[model samples]
Target: MSHRESDRRQFLKKSAATAAAVSVPYFLTGQNAAAADEQKANESNDRPIVGCIGTGSRWHAVGPNAMQLGDVAAVCDVDANHAAGAKKKVTEIQSKKGSDRQVDVYEDYQKILDRKDIEIVTIVTTDHWHSKIAIEAMKAGKDVYCEKPLTLTIDEGKKICQVAKETGRVFQVGTQQRSEMGLRFLQAVALVRNGRIGEVQNIAVAIGGAPACNSIPVVDVPSGLNWEKWLGQAPLVDYRWAKNGNTVNTRCHYEFRWWYEYSGGKLTDWGAHHVDIAQWAIGQSEDGMGPRSIEPIYAKHPVDFKDGMPVQDDRYNTATQFHIKATFGDGVVMDIKDSHQDELGFDNGIMFMGTEGRFLVNRGKIVGAPVDALKENPLPENAIAEIYGGSMPARGNAHMANFFEAVKTRKLPISDVFTHHRALTTCHLSNIAIRLNRSLKWDPQTEQILGDDQANAMQSRDARKGYEVTV
Candidate 1:
């Protein structure tokens, strides 16, 4: 074995041993354990104290949904305006619920982590900030509810998983498709698992392409915005703004996804959602199981590249169009691409095709020959119950409720971090293949790109000083 591989294996072994030493098993002996269990059950009825970080457009919905399950003790954002706005929204929601608790606002997230009273933290930060904050929060003894696309790079996923196992924290990824009210995703997974869809042959996931844009002009950093902290582990770049008509500086907020420095664009954005469900349905949503090979069949980016690195930093550099394919160990082929005119006839969603049946599923509907067959012979009750994590369909706030239940019981949630990391790794691999414009082989057990040094180097990136993410 190479020295690097040996070192990594040793580190992982040590981490697992440390985690085993710290983890408290579910069962304990004697009356003390019974008393402790009773105390925990009583505390579960009391509202959990929550703190929300990154109050952006998405958080407007996520923050309110979280409030339904917990008390909002604090709201935080790097931008002062966003923090204040979220604080006001929290107060309004609490008033409507007939609770008069006041919500605190902060420009720094560390203050929230420092508080002992906050039991849970909902992270809605940009793609680059997810793993760093999540690891720190777990170390601080706070359960985390992080948004999807859980890592900025493949190595970040491994770090987050290790820290979660070591701390035994209740870590939930925000892939709400798993708990959608109609259970469309769950039903599809159940059908395939129960042999309703013969042996799975192929899967297709259609996430739209990234946008192309000309170089944006650098502008003065806006007031009340800490640009340095916002750039956090990402490489430093001049602050740029969009010009409105003639002379208006619209500061960067939601547009960070288009840059390769900050995110993997649509590959990570929607891929985190749809590709995750595909992995779960195919029984690959676990540690040490992922795509064995990835190929970039076709691709186009907004800028030029040299050795897989984008040549320009000022333009929207992510792939604008692409068709990527991944092959698993069991010969299952997963084709991920932009909107394409194809036989599947789906513009957005997932499609599963097998010998006996085929089906298409999205947020709105699920249809196929297998579903039609289900009417004649309904799915077993146990199968349906297991898919919903032992709960029936149509439960209010099902995703958030599941996380809270896991927090109370110390059980893994439906979208736990380990499986989410495995799925996100597939997305990252697709992006890497596209950037390099070649086929690459992967070793899932070692978590490395095999026999290709250049591709292996893409597994991680160097963080700027003061923003390094270490387990």
Candidate 2:
């Protein structure tokens, strides 16, 4: 171990000793503690030790939320600036709570994983890094709270699920829609599942498309940023300056979504939210259940493609315009489009059209003839609560709280990894179809692209050496 690692270990050991007398729960030592003893300690402890990874723009909010449930022991990021900022924020939150706690900052996440005391890890990393880090964390005996769009590809989802099952780790996917205030999404899903929408025929999901841009100019790697480490499992490529050219930052941080090399663009970004809710409402959120076929009716890309692979490496090549249709085995067609300006006449929300009535729901509001009818005769008080696995409605930070609760009780959270993966599979299939500009059959049961070898091969990508995510 390096001097820094040694110092951190000593600090953690000292902190653990101080916690026993200070009435604050510190790290849970994995050494020589029986399962029953660990459970008792977990139940009685005032707080858990949490490590926040990928402290970037999104983590500004996620980090604070995590501090609410546990003491943040460390913050890790590829960017030194992000790690420092997150460490400062963690300290501020701890201090405000009348605790004099110090947070360790590290550029390498492995250090955080190597610590035996970190019982929980929050992964808010970029799209490509989610699965690899999450899997390793679970193997390290740490429960995980991973953000939405859980995996970069369908294969990663399968691997994550397998590891989660084998390890019996509490894994929560950050699809807050499942536990939003007023339980609007839960209520909407209840209405559909309860047959409020009779014989659901179609659903429409409106989300933004990926932006198309010319080749970004290659530039020098900035100070305090590890470009190679940030790339992680992605193929090696030269760092480039931002399009604006004023800042030295590259197409990293929050801007990585526009690149197919790292992400599937809005197809996974926003679709992870909207598509997930769609699957829940339609009763296809579980494993072995998903769309039977995906058709990319129309698509526009920033660069040329051969066999679904972008030819140019410099440009933001993800599709900018797309109208993809996914048909479930039940003959329910889900139309995922860039906007609602098409014939459906909808905007950025989910619309469920059924024989009895139709309803539209988003973060803003839930409306339609079915929902309006509920005004006269509201749903039972327990209706929404029942749909959320017998738990009450979750308001601000309730999703995170749910993960903590599951960590203690060893129960599955509201948004488990299995269902999130099934939903994300639909999103990935849509992107694959759009990239190929063709319709393809899917077998959700086997999690395979049926009879299309090319499409099936796209389910997983070869990871770079040292970053491979093996089961």
**lDDT of candidate 2?**
0.82
* Candidate 2 local lDDT, 1-471, one digit each (tens): 764345334433543342232221222223332233334544776688999999988888777877767788999999998888888888887897676767898989999999987999999999999999999999999999999889999999999999999999999898888876457788888888667888788988998877665567888887999999999999999987665554333468777888888899889998999999998777676656789999998988888999999998887877788889998876789999888754535668899999898888888888888898887977887666656656563345667766776788777777889889999999999989988888999988899999899999999999999999888
User: Per-prediction TM-score, please?
Assistant: 0.89, 0.89
> How far does residue 404 in candidate 1 sit from its true spot (Å)?
0.6
Per-model lDDT: 0.82, 0.82
Candidate 1's error at 103, in angstroms? Answer: 1.7
Model 1 segments more than 4 A misplaced: 1-45, 243-251
Give lDDT for model 1: 0.82
